[model samples]
Target: MAQQAYMTETDNQGSGHEPRGTRIRRLMSRLANRLFAGGRDGRGIWRRGMVLTALAVLVGLIMLLHAQVPNTIGNSGSLIETFLPWLGVSVPVLLVLALVRRSATALIAVLFPAIVWLNLFGGLLGDKAGTGGDLTVATHNVNADNPDPAGTARDVAASGADVVALEELKTSAVPVYEKALASTYRYHSVQGTVGLWSKYPMTGVRAVDIQLGWTRAMRATVTTPEGQVAVYVAHMPSVRVKMEAGFTARQRDKSADALGEAIADEKLTKVVLLGDLNGTMNDRALNGVTSQMRSTQGAAGSGFGFSWPASFPMARIDQILVKGIEPESSWTLPETGSDHLPVAARVSVDTSS
Candidate 1:
């Protein structure tokens, strides 16, 4: 009877230990399964995050490209490109984060804005040695609707620019400009919406067809003390704003191409182009003129001096470009009645060469 009871106790103890071990093994296996599944689910989360990052990068790049188009067709307003160059920096930063995470799509999307930024500002990095000269010329588009043409003219004439180009000349207000500028400019000519007022002798003043009409653009021979320089004053057609047609930049681009061709055929080695281009120097559409001429303000101005809608100027549409002159200084004048403030530059004609 004592042996039987002892054997029964031993069997019970052994059976209890086996069951406990089995239960522990099953629990461990279940935990291992959950951990493995969680890892797989975490990969999906990472993929989704990568997709979102790529979408953001793509949207940023598209915005950057859209901003790059010319404003000649329709003004991009003050909000888009003028205050938006810094927006492009976001793309590369996001791309870096994506790359760190090994996201292929996000890395690919970054290339768009990268190409655009380089296209717009790359040439600016090259060496810009001025070819020295004697005469200084400046240009501006004193808005035709300017309430104070006299004040605007006075400010521009005060710059002491030997030659000044004005565009967007309103026919009714021509007398006002003529009277205010007469004291400084001894010679002047107008063709369509463009005009040239000079302290020097101006000849061969004929209108150049930019396809706007009779004379929105013109070329003149300014016989300065240094030599006869070909000066072109132009105001391409103003782009209109409409809710239906996005940007109408094609017409302006075509006009620019024509003007560029005209300029290229000129025999003179030294050329000066001045007026309200209605487009930024950074715009690739203006490459027609920008490819040949150097912007004075871009070369010597302190910053990205915005010059349109004078109340709160945000982008520089007015410009002075030179082919064979040295720019000493460039700046914008104070507000006038017109929507645009005058932009002036001091360029020395390198006659010594």
Candidate 2:
């Protein structure tokens, strides 16, 4: 009887002197057991990953209601919209986490973002390009500090674009560009930091004001075989993101408004705009310009024709937009010495219309 009493006392002492880690493990095991009850029909589906489920739901709502997000704080709405397509990345990640935790609730919540993302971007995955077009146009932001202006001109000329627009033109490099492209393009004009070269006859070329006090945009009439088209070449003011100021793009936004007004006033029925807009088509600040026009890449390009930062393109800031011209094919040109890769599009202008 004494031996039995001694053994009982030893057992009590061991329980009281258990290590902290051991005690934590025991507590966690009990909690996990309560969370995941064994059952053949997945009885504990609703009891897991409460935090993960909440996060997944929030991500889905953010994607679904992104436009409603206010820009009062640091222009967060524009920033979000600029990279809106990337928001889909969270869906697959959340799904993986849900599967690992056997969380039915989180898995179901993840579907919200998945569906919303597919609805927005699914159409972009297919090849919509046609085989024929009457005119081909291209645009490039030949970096102001490009090392080889002549070679860059030759590269764009090789694309066989009937009309080409170059932005960020340096005063010194204008002659080099003109000389290199002179052989292929007979008509050309340069105004401030932007220029346009065309195989067809060009007239009525003039600098357009975008409220920067100097010319960064221009409009010209190109007489193609089909008819006359008013082409606009613009290099919108660059935008920056700062820790103190957030997305600093008020100037760009103003310029876009002015540019939109200018386009709205054009006399010609067929219009094509090309340039480095410095913002994605999804950015709301550009609504003044985008609302009335259509993107060639969106209409005919096979993929997300991201054309900026040639080394690692993440956005299609360089664009070809149209009011009446129909896009047949769209694509990006090979990398030049400049920072941005040139974008090209083939468009059909019906003669009978």
- Going through the candidates in order, what is the number of backbone clashes in each? 7, 0
What's the lDDT for residue 121 in model 1?
50
Mind giving the per-residue lDDT tens digits that candidate 2 earns over 271-293? Answer: 99999998889888899899989
Candidate 1 lDDT by residue in tens digits, 236-332: 6665456876555667767888888889988888898988777777566677898999887778666666788788776788888888776766778
Model 2 alpha-carbon drift over 4 Å, by segment: 1-43, 351-353
Error of 2 at 223 (Å): 0.4
TM-score (C-alpha, index-matched) for candidate 1: 0.70
What are the candidates' C-alpha RMSDs? 11.7, 9.5
Clashing pairs in 1: 73-248, 132-350, 133-349, 133-350, 134-349, 192-215, 310-339
RMSD of 2: 9.5
Local error of candidate 2 at residue 113 (angstroms): 0.4
